[model samples]
Target: MGVYSEGFLEAVDAALADFEVEIRQLGAAASDAQILAAIERVVLALNSVSQGVAGGVIDTDEREQLCLFIDEVMTENGIEVGELAARHGVSRYAITDRWRRW
Candidate 1:
């Protein structure tokens, strides 16, 4: 049984795709403040996804994919998984377990 429908995952993917484009556009020419703002957006997005998973709005497979996405985003932004886990009130082990599967 799945907690999230296929339509939900597709919507998430579409939103992520838009985010990626926005990040790219905030490239070298973007100011330090702009970069920080962009990072904040990513953080908010990850937090939203984490909250959804924690609240049982996302299924196991969706959680796995979201975790992978979170890992990638953290790596790219030089953020620590432990830091994110702490912020989200989730166990680092849980995050890492899904991240490893990615």
Candidate 2:
């Protein structure tokens, strides 16, 4: 089990931005495998950020619910904090700080 925090959304958003850029670069290569690889890379990036955030918090069913909520928010906004942070070249702590404001 794992908990999701606002930080999670931030992390995903940051990763998404990077992923989009990566997809574009791969798109220029014009290969299906390259595009798929780029997508997988984005997923891995997001997974890495989520693992980091989850590791910092408690591990339990309650935490999983929280993470679900975070995913919902990210979906609505079509962005993620981690991805945004990466786009801006900032630290996760900085992304967490932004969440603290909320």
Candidate 3:
């Protein structure tokens, strides 16, 4: 009954975990640029984690998952959006703007 296979979901989860690890390693003093770059990498990885997932097919649930993942990462890493934007001129909400396919 799932839109995606369990294996594909697991891979996506792993990709998120990898991004979380990167954020944890970056710690409290990480520059916005650094965090944004990591976000870009994970967005790309998520966009490509499974075949037949491209061409503007990001479903509602998938989008929610992505947003939650990104927000949770920022929260867990103590990333303040206004501060990060001031630091690097990049909005935290815009992390997927430059990298996500859908």
Winning candidate number (TM-score): 3
RMSD after CA superposition, every candidate: 7.9, 13.6, 3.2
Better candidate by lDDT, 1 or 3: 3
Residue 62 of candidate 2: its Cα lDDT? 37
The per-model lDDT (C-alpha) reads: 0.53, 0.49, 0.73
Best-performing candidate as measured by lDDT: 3
Give candidate 3's whole-model lDDT.
0.73
Q: Could you tell me which residue pairs clash in candidate 3?
A: none
Please, what are the lDDT tens digits per residue for candidate 2 over residues 1-102? 434567776776686677556654544434444543544455566556646665333334533444454434333444444554466566423433233212
Query: What global local distance difference test value does model 1 have?
Result: 0.53
**Candidate 1 regions off by >4 Å?**
1-8, 53-102
Question: For residues 1-102, what per-residue lDDT tens digits would candidate 1 score against the true structure?
Answer: 455556545556665665566656654455545544554565455445545543235446765665566456544654465665666576654644422321
Rank ordering of all candidates by lDDT, starting from the highest: 3, 1, 2
